[model samples]
Target: MFWSKKNGNKSQEFQEILKLRSELSFKGIQFDKALFQLLTPLFEENPLLFKDWKDLQNKVLQAVEEKTWTIQDEIEFIESYVNLWKIAKSDELHTQLTIKGNQQDIQIFPLITFGAIQNALQLGYNSMREHPLKIRIQLSQSTLQLEVSNRVNHYLQNQADNMQFEYWKNRLEYRYPEKHQLFVNSNSNIFKSTLILQIA
Candidate 1:
């Protein structure tokens, strides 16, 4: 809703959104049954809940019902994930997403970026008092590159160094074998991770 109001949607892009929205609405988790019956009435009072429901379908629940993921979906998922926390702690954030290359052509795993983003928010001060959080993405050829940087507390520095992010490593290896690389590193005031995924 806010996206359309803020940026006038081109005819093609608008139609694409409407079409995907329609498919996702009708394709999975029938509202006629148990889960729907439990949550229907609350939707009217809590608008954000409704929004989360849709995002949950696209960003999470769809793993069972769908096999395809567009770059736009990934971008929106990242934005939505951050915005929830940002809304609650707006003053504590100095974060931004810097995207490059062609978003439309890249195919990515939904929620693949979640682990890195979560760690950034947790390990970093993420406020005016510290250096800003950097969420950067770039696509070149058949590979996708992601890097997240944060300013963290000195006492918690050990925790940052110990993070293995094995979930991501295992998944990426299973999907792309040696084609992908994932790792995390930190120095005194900054902690960061870099992931290069081949997602052709």
Candidate 2:
């Protein structure tokens, strides 16, 4: 009787292990499918995506090495990224940009700012229903700010968006430590993100 119970326990353990492996395999397949869906549009429509990204990467590296980066450079990058979205979803996405302030010589981490803008664009695009997406950029001697807003059919706020905003916040904290302040807030109807870098 003891031997039979021990064998049964071993069989149960083996079954549990098999079940865990099957679960992991199913999750892996789900992840792959999600990734394929996310990338299919870029592959099918925007064959130039890689080339454009490479060019932008080079420009960013050059700016960082030369220390000649400006706000306009960042604006252009954002415009290009928005343009890609426009090309991809021309009828679904509408964008308006308003840039204010005259300070253009302020040095900054263009990539970090770009990441923040990308997050903003994602939030805006996802929330935009029938209204146009609006982006406002303000530059000053001491601060730079960007505000993105749009209307949605339903309020579908996700932690992923907040996490993206926090990703940049943590990055800024690590890089600027004491010289920067990052704030991101969302509402039932509108999503807004603001980044202020203190350049004295």
Lowest summed lDDT across 10 adjacent residues in model 2 is found at 26-35
C-alpha displacement of 187 in model 2, angstroms? 2.3
Best by lDDT: 1
lDDT of 1 by residue, 1-200 (tens): 35564365575565565445433432322221333444467678878866875665554555432344777777786776566556445477778789998887676655566557766765567786447888999888788889998886676835445323444444444445577888778788778889888887
**TM-score of every candidate:** 0.66, 0.63
Which ranges of candidate 1 are over 4 A from the true structure? Answer: 1-59, 64-68, 160-164
State the displacement of the C-alpha of residue 92, model 1, in Å, after optimal TM-score superposition: 1.5
The global C-alpha lDDT for each of the candidates, from Candidate 1 onward, is 0.63, 0.57
**Candidate 2 accuracy as TM-score:** 0.63
**What local lDDT score does residue 150 receive in model 1, on the 0 to 100 scale?**
83
Off by over 4 Å in 2: 1-54, 61-68, 126-130, 152-155, 159-163
Native-structure RMSD, model 1: 15.7
Clashing pairs in 2: none
